[model samples]
Target: MVFELRPASSADLCFARELTRETMLRYYIQHDLRWQDEAFDVAWAGRENWLICQGDSVLGFLSLSRDAKALYIRELHVIKTDRCKGAGSWAIEQVFSMAREERRSSLRLTVFKNNPAQVLYQRMGLSVVGEEDCFLRMERMCSAAP
Candidate 1:
């Protein structure tokens, strides 16, 4: 399936919040991590939020931000029914493109240490750069080829 991303607006706030809450709850629970509903608000406001869609249906969302150093992927969440169908990989590819477009040297994100998504990140060429009590920081350096 072809995946497309559109800028997420205030109108999408609730959908974004709920999608994040649901998708993350499982990981949080399994890892015994704390979650606050208000945390989603930060991504809603400060980042470049995109609704990942397949044609007319909304499949997931991701938030990205860039600084002088690297592009940061703040959040990436897909609907439970849509997991393992390549949506997450497609979104990460878009972030890689964004990093290249912005002239950033690398893409960075933090994932729960125990979340299986870490495997996907590694497969996409992101390597673990650091470790926190609950999270693993990953980075993928942009290649010069393109």
Candidate 2:
């Protein structure tokens, strides 16, 4: 489907937060972790937020940041109705492009253990590199674009 990644604005904050929280709440519960709206807001304010939209309809959102070692995907959540419709994969491809443009050697993200998104990350070429109490850190190396 045709979609665009628009830079998320303050107006889109509620949508992003709702979508992410809905998507993550179950995982948080399963992992016995807390879901704090304040923490999410703080993170949203700190990261680069992008809305994945097909025309005027928002299908998902992506929150990204970069460290010295990698382009980190802090959050990626597709709307429930849009799941499995290629939006997630497309968003990931865009992140890969961004990582290359930024000269990062790798793409990195943390997923709650047993979250189904782990399958997609693996399919997109990321490998689990580390594990924490409740998360699996995944990474995929890439050469920067010329």
lDDT tens per residue, model 2, 6-90: 9998888889888888999998888788999999999999999999999989899999999897999999999999999999999
lDDT of 1 by residue, 1-146 (tens): 99999999988888888888787888888888777767778657888899999999999999888889799999899999998999999999999988888778999999988788999999999999999888999999986336
Q: Which segments of candidate 1 are over 4 A away from where they belong?
A: 30-32, 144-146
Q: Give me the displacement of residue 79 in model 1, in angstroms.
A: 0.6
Q: After superposition, how far is residue 144 of candidate 2 from its true place, in Å?
A: 1.2
Q: Backbone clashes in each candidate structure, one number apiece? A: 0, 0
TM-scores for all candidates: the values are 0.92, 0.97
For model 2, what is the C-alpha lDDT against the true structure? 0.92
Which candidate number has the best TM-score?
2
| TM-score, model 2 to reference | 0.97
lDDT of each: 0.89, 0.92
